[model samples]
Target: MFARSLPIISLLSIISLRSVSAVDYSETYVGCVSGTGTSGALASPNVNTISDCNYACADAGYTYAYFQYQSAGSYCSCKNVGPSASEITPAVSGNTNCGGAAAGVNALATDYYYNNCYNSPTAEDTTSQSTFDACFERCTTYTNAFVSPAGNVYSCVCSNTASTGTAQNCGVSGTYFAYAHTATSSPSIVERRKRRLSERLKREEQTRLNRFCPAGLEACVIPGLDDSFECIDTSSELESCGGCLYGSTGNSNASTGIDCSTLPGASFGGTTCSAGRCEISACKEGYNLVEGRCDWHV
Candidate 1:
């Protein structure tokens, strides 16, 4: 009885080992699912749903899988089961071959276009519809015909034979179309002109001020004169006025025989000399004459 039991146990152990060895660790196409895009190879062992294809492929030991449709439509799912952790790279296809090994190729192409090409306004408007139709038509034309510099990949071109004539008709309208173009152009030109005018006015004002003040010289308007006088010019009688004044100094300097250069200790007034000339004979308190010149006492 012991010898018979030993044979049975050994046979059962052999059968279990065979079953474990039979499991294929290779990548495979699981089933149909949804995805979008047009370039790059897809991984295997995938089933289609509006789910995360990246996670699915990674879970199945695949580097990546391609999705074919933006909506809920037929798609290909793949996974990589290559030994030694090698990635399964597939050939780029114009259409998704959903049933077999080509299942996720179309989805990959759609993703490539939308992410890379459709980001720009010119590319997006031109290729969005074309890309959609090309995916539908890829079941037949698997040729590597068109390549986008922006997308950095090859893709299928959809037939635009119908809409070409209509686009030409729209370009030929009337005066309204001309007016629209003019309207856009005029504002930019006007803004440039206004900026130039403002700059010119500022430059002219600076030039006039520089002529009279001539850098590094303090300038003062002469009392009772329309012109300004520079302190650098000793010949100008206005500079002899005790201190600088900003505007027309109304006859105050001429009426008082006070030589501005001789004012003992003068302070700036709002617009005229007030209490620094000793020739006035009488002055307000906190003032006194020193050597025939008015000076502040305190």
Candidate 2:
């Protein structure tokens, strides 16, 4: 039985290898990042969607990006450093529906949570923030931000500057929450996603082409054929090549592929076709082709 299962096991192994990618981004979602140290913040109101925000952050040279909803639509904040363990609340996916005042935390605009300070002395501030989203946005402005609730007032404060340092137990007397921003994205994952997206687009294009062209012939256009498509064997056709383009002139007849041998300067020129394209390696020694015209080599 073990011998019979060898091939099955090997096939499964190959399938698993093919399926592996960077990581499951959905599983990695960490609520809403609120507090961060006092640095590495690039904020923009235009960015929407988590992927777009992550890409923008990566482009801005940040390793982590955070998305949050505010009064002004949605905003994305980029930062290099990640939140600390102490700052992160455990498994808080959305704003906790404060079952009355006992719960203390208010309902965010939508629902947001992150690795942040929860009624800790680490984030003590004088500026008053009315809502959690406001406090979150305020924290993003600085490298580190924390929210402390004194009675009904929520004060947003900065805990540290730079990527280094630790949170202090300062806001013990008041209900407070602190959060730090951490880099949740990496260049490798971005590249993988891009590659997958590109492959999907290519597959979609090919599927569309399949609907139009017969077997063996791919949907393509000949050189000089603008806005026109033809079914041609790119593997053997001398014109369409891997794509289409008669060369710099773009003056090839759409119905028939270019005949390099028929050209004046290319006469007696040893032209060969490879991979569905034609190429003239050399013009008969004394011949030259220049400026859309071919002539004898000077």
The best candidate in terms of TM-score: 2
User: What digit string (tens of lDDT, one per residue) describes model 2 on residues 1-298?
Assistant: 0000011111111012222222222112323324322244667666545455554443333444565544445556665444432333322333431111111111111112333334444443447866544565555434455565544555667655432244333334343454554223223433453454445445545566656777877665543457556776655655455443332122233333454445565646455556655666555556875654557865
Write one digit per residue (lDDT tens) for candidate 1, span 28-91.
Answer: 1211222332234343323344234433332222322454442334343432221110111222
Write down the lDDT of every candidate, Cα atoms only. 0.29, 0.43
Q: Candidate 2, which ten residues in sequence have the lowest lDDT sum?
A: 1-10
Q: Which candidate is the best by lDDT?
A: 2
RMSD of each: 31.0, 15.1
The list of candidate 2 runs beyond 4 A from truth reads 1-24, 28-181, 184-195, 221-228, 246-264, 268-298
True-structure lDDT of candidate 1: 0.29
